[model samples]
Target: MPPAYPRSPRRNGVHYANAAMTVLLGLGSNLGDRCDNMEKAIEALAGLPGTSLLRWSTVYESNALLAPDSPPMWDKPFLNAAVELSTSLKPLDLLAATQAIEKRLGRVEGERWAPRTIDVDLLAYDDETITTPELVVPHVGVRERAFVLAPLAEIVPSRRLPGTSETVLQLKRRIDDSLPAWMGVVNVTPDSFSDGGRWLKDDKPTTAQLELLDGNYIDIGGESTRPGAVDVDSETEWRRVAPVLEYLDQHFSGRLLRPKISIDTRSPTTAARAIEAGVSIVNDVSGFANRAMIEILAGSRCDLVLMHNLSVPADPSNVLPHDCDPLAVLRSWFGEHLEILERAGIARERVIIDPGIGFGKSAIQSLEIIDRARELMEFDCRVLFGHSRKSYLESMTKVPPSERDPETVAVSANLARRGVEILRVHALDLHRRFWRVYQRTA
Candidate 1:
């Protein structure tokens, strides 16, 4: 269990007694001025009778759901949040107060899961369950709701819900990982495992990247993180990658539709700078191990890609003796590291998990990771599959990495079938075709 957060300063009108119980509330908005509505709701909750806001979580954006009674359709993205309150009010009173705050914030009558200016649902109260016609203690579907559990974990990962053994962190990781995102590969290194020096011009990268692929997004990496590749200093890596990001940021402005940009780096300095340059993600292969890296990422607004890696090259001679379950080890590693992130206030939704296809794993282990990618959803963050043109595919196909596009595409489709969220690849044309055909079938 994680340590409890210390009591915070009290609000002007609310007095929190030492005996006050801590409660967690889920707040969200999908309609007009979402962030503003959430702020208003937080202010309202802070002054509720016998309640003081102890802490609030960083907001997370997630796909909204359509009304169950209405035809299935994708709604606007919801800005979701979690608030911890130190309160002495009865559960019913707290619930009524939150509902009143919603109405006051201009939440009008609407169908279930419909867009709202503000919505507050009582998540958990004092580890006690009140089963009644009007209320459910643990929140009817909180245990399985990733959007709710993720923000809740951000503020209080160790908190245990009433009548359940899982803590907020555990529940967050165990929640079903939904939402699919694609990532095109934009290799900028001179020695990338495949496609080395092809995109190696000092010119702007917006054109190079846009010309390379068109899909959900593109991952821009400066250094070659292939097997046995050497580490580059942060300055050198930034020099190679910053220009691309700056150009992309400028080029995408005023465009109605632009792909998301992800920066792949292991250096904390590079990650921080790339985020400052407007990259939406930092794909770190070190599983966010370094404290500086974690701190920098926590302070930035970008989503994180924490990949399981050995932090060094994989020498075939150093193979495990026997009976080592790589997947199990990776899972435990993620569980521990993710706790550290949550304890430090990193929102769980702002992360994606990568099994590290070839960072330090053997061909067999890499194959196992692909076959079992869905199992990684146990970590809750979106699972990213980066098996494009890797050595593992070459081993299976007996072709050089550059000629492994077919193998890569086949494996990607399989991973997609297994519910993987992000697919990093070089064959954008084939994937575009696949998406078109697959969407119709899906």
Candidate 2:
């Protein structure tokens, strides 16, 4: 009997928790029963093994950062607070748990920066600074959001924002009303909200159009992302984008026009063909989760743009809200894709990240991502914003697809201020004008 299992020892029925690690989290609510949502969040946090709730700062109320264009359904007040926790769990595990709690608390999805029932943000994880795809230990927004800064200062006066070489108090001193740039819109799709398919059937694209680009972007996609659009096959997409690439190669030959040309597709065959045809970038809207697509891009001499997309069905009626924060979700999704890319031999530098402005996100969330585009700079790769004329802009301006140029230009200017090097817009002339204005202002 296997030596009687070494004679089972008598049990005292005693259990001990693991050594606790210190963590700081920012908690806020603007939905039903704000106080209750926060309290529940605290309880959920405490329920995690190897964690102990230390203290929470007093809750403060604030207005939504970017209010939605639609009329308010109710007087939704925002509540903000901070929590200190002692946990034996590793930083990533703790963060995963925090996200789970947020989803559990009826935090319905909306646009970026939209109000919510509860928002739990990891403020800091010990004194360490981490820069992994999964976790940026010192949260990216630590120094920017006054709501987060005020409560954090109240609790941890001596604490410093990691990687900044500044104390919490010092960071607070620099806080202001400004927001950071997020992602630029690159529409490989034909009928995208902003530019549409002006470059689709090219006839020497006018200088005012794609011809004037500084050869700085990764040529994006061929599908149409306009609402109620039909999806095209790999062959159709290849045909749609091939001429544009061939033209670029012919016109800007030997000039290093743009460092790379990106093929935006979900099909492995398309990616492979694009690569064979001299495309230098692979902007996969499906997030490179497809094994075949990953294999095609693996070890290739092309850069990749990994955009976020929900596998779930999307509803057009639910516009993006002003308080929806997808940073954590994006972080998790990127971490998964990064591993896939790495296994496929893609260099880290060749990778770019897009939050997928309107793929499956609400309008408010899109705006929030745009407003906080700089937060993604923490990833240390070139950021691409593809929000040219997305539904969010349409929702806000009430402009039909053909008439959204002015709004798109305004958004582009805002993105430029956030240090976005690549702005993928629809109209080449509009982009050219925007660049001229940007250069002058800079």
Candidate 3:
């Protein structure tokens, strides 16, 4: 008989039944030698002690998800594919392994959704339903990403999402479907990864810039959370963000051009101030666990972006263990925070969930979260993806942060195809370009 499959390690130090878990992972690249990146990623994955790559789907070459009118330099070809893995490592442990592989393959850190040689994601971990502070199984974005579902259906036609009973093939059938509206990114900071300080300059509407927006989301941030970014006091943050909020209110209020503005803040004071300034959305980079922030939004009609963040130190040098799934941790955090928001009087529809790309995460962990974004949707909230020019993209490409737009657009299109309502990007031109492409194809 084949070797008995190892059992799930343990939870709270209790052993669970030993079962072989099959995980579906998606990989893609447009920079360097794309095929080589996928091969290296697979090689790295095979080195994991308790895992083996079982099968892979044919690689598909798709058009870059940017506008035809955009600069020709911005459009690059992408190679998309998916694979299945048989592993004994728990969900979190597998995520850690994938992160290690990404780092080893020359993934530098910086920017949101830049291009790279290889990107790997955990599409599913068996049929188990898991919700932890660090991980949510079934990846929240799977139902919507064609890059993921298209490749996944090729490999696991009969596989179904754990909770919904929707097979991979069924989800792929709707790849051409369109959403009610496009989700927009509102940058509240002066130095965000993508379009730093582009919106709030001189407290005036940058019509040239605003004309490029593809969707109606306006993600406004006051603080710069980029790596090595300086933390600012609420007063300083207010100074930076207030003008932009006021400008939006003054120019776009009650207009058809008015996009939904999401305050990208972690501070209660900031959230309060932005909401009061006519901002209807609250994107708390720090999972909505901040009691003060929750209290402020709970009383108002603001939509919330509850992202997963690991406060615990994630030293890149350390190999992550099965107990460290960030999605699981995020799930636990969401449960607690969801109740808190409900108790504080925040309506459920006003909530959106983000996996918090790159916030306190290793490169591999970020990739895993993206792969498993669909799993996080189990919470029943609209999913928002803000991978625009994040560090993971830089890590994968080994390129400087400023030059990752093509890569970022590719990721955005992938996520948008996956069903993500919002694609938080820094470049309005890029967003418009991709949106046009998506519309034409969709």
Candidate 4:
């Protein structure tokens, strides 16, 4: 039988100052007023001392486990959900709090898996493995049960269990291998928004740095396309990015496991040179509006990131009309360009569509792009979102460009759930840790 412990009353007007750890909890109810019981239990859990409820998954209905000759009332289906929280409480205290929640909500000491008003199980607590007579977490049955995994995967799809190697999404086994690729950003220019001029002078990017960033594609940009920026000539852009390309070609030319190199440029001349430098992808911030650029890409075997933008140096005022839908605008623009690319003999598969967040849209419009990013899947091409550390993050808060990575990560996780294929980000280490590292153990 599971441990039964009642929670003690909390001391009023006290704040927990300990370092908080993340916790995952599984909740289920099959008894009277199942929905009400689950809601009350969740509320109680949220109200626990030093525990801040993060997010919960959608409630899933599944059949209950019952013993032979069990009463008919004990055979009802269950409503299940998974919750994530940050807490300063120790593992046993957290477990006791959950058990108290179950008891207070009318659960009775009875057979295991028997129908109850509520069942709260500590699925995991910050990568800590604990096995005792009273409790075993990550909940012994979490991996094999759909009721637990289905709800948990909705929130922490890439989270790995404490004693397991496979992530929640991988154990669920629904997604293919193609999804969730990371695109590391390497800004070579002096005026770029996020890490402008950091790589200039003595801090130039090297093969070791790119390898450390660990992106499937290393996106090296020579120009700053931030709002209200000046445009450099094609030769100047090529000169700025040439050394990085040369270093990559010199070291990674014959390596079997090197990241693919992408050149971010709008100038046809720079694109030609980058192609000659053996780059595999061209990220055109100007959305290939130049006919000469289209002609150049049409003749190359490189993949193209055909992005949407109103102007090169992003005019803050050049936004879609107030009444126009942003997705519709993207569709019209992509539809026209896709046909153009096809006519130019560049296959659609070689094209990766980017909505170019914050490029020409207003803050609200940029948000709408993220909120409805999944709709871009209709284009039949991989979607790459470059929303890292942009001004749009400042719309809700007053964070500077350098301090926006946390917000960037929040949006990146949302994009991952929304099915965006690739995330072009400045903070690669943060993204990788959040996505792959279990419980921030890295």
In model 1, how large is the Cα lDDT of residue 442? 58
Sort every candidate by TM-score, greatest first: 1, 4, 3, 2
Q: All predictions: root-mean-square deviation over Cα?
A: 8.1, 20.7, 20.3, 19.0
Candidate 4 steric clashes: 0
**Candidate 4: segments with Cα more than 4 A from true spot:** 1-178, 202-213, 438-442
User: TM per model?
Assistant: 0.60, 0.52, 0.55, 0.59
lDDT of 3: 0.65
Candidate 2: C-alpha RMSD to true structure equals 20.7
Off by over 4 Å in 1: 1-179, 202-206, 313-322
Q: How many collisions per candidate?
A: 0, 38, 58, 0
By summed lDDT, the worst window of 10 consecutive residues in model 4 runs over 1-10
Off by over 4 Å in 2: 1-197, 200-215, 218-220, 257-259, 311-324
Judged by TM-score, which candidate is best?
Answer: 1
Position 271, candidate 2: lDDT: 84
In the range 62-161, model 4's lDDT, one tens digit per residue, is: 5676677778766677777778878888988888888888889999998875778888889999998889998898889777776677666545766899
- Cα error, residue 96 of model 4, in Å, equals 55
Model 1 lDDT vs. the true structure?
A: 0.72
Error of 2 at 267 (Å): 1.4
Candidates' C-alpha lDDT = 0.72, 0.64, 0.65, 0.76
- Candidate with maximal lDDT: 4
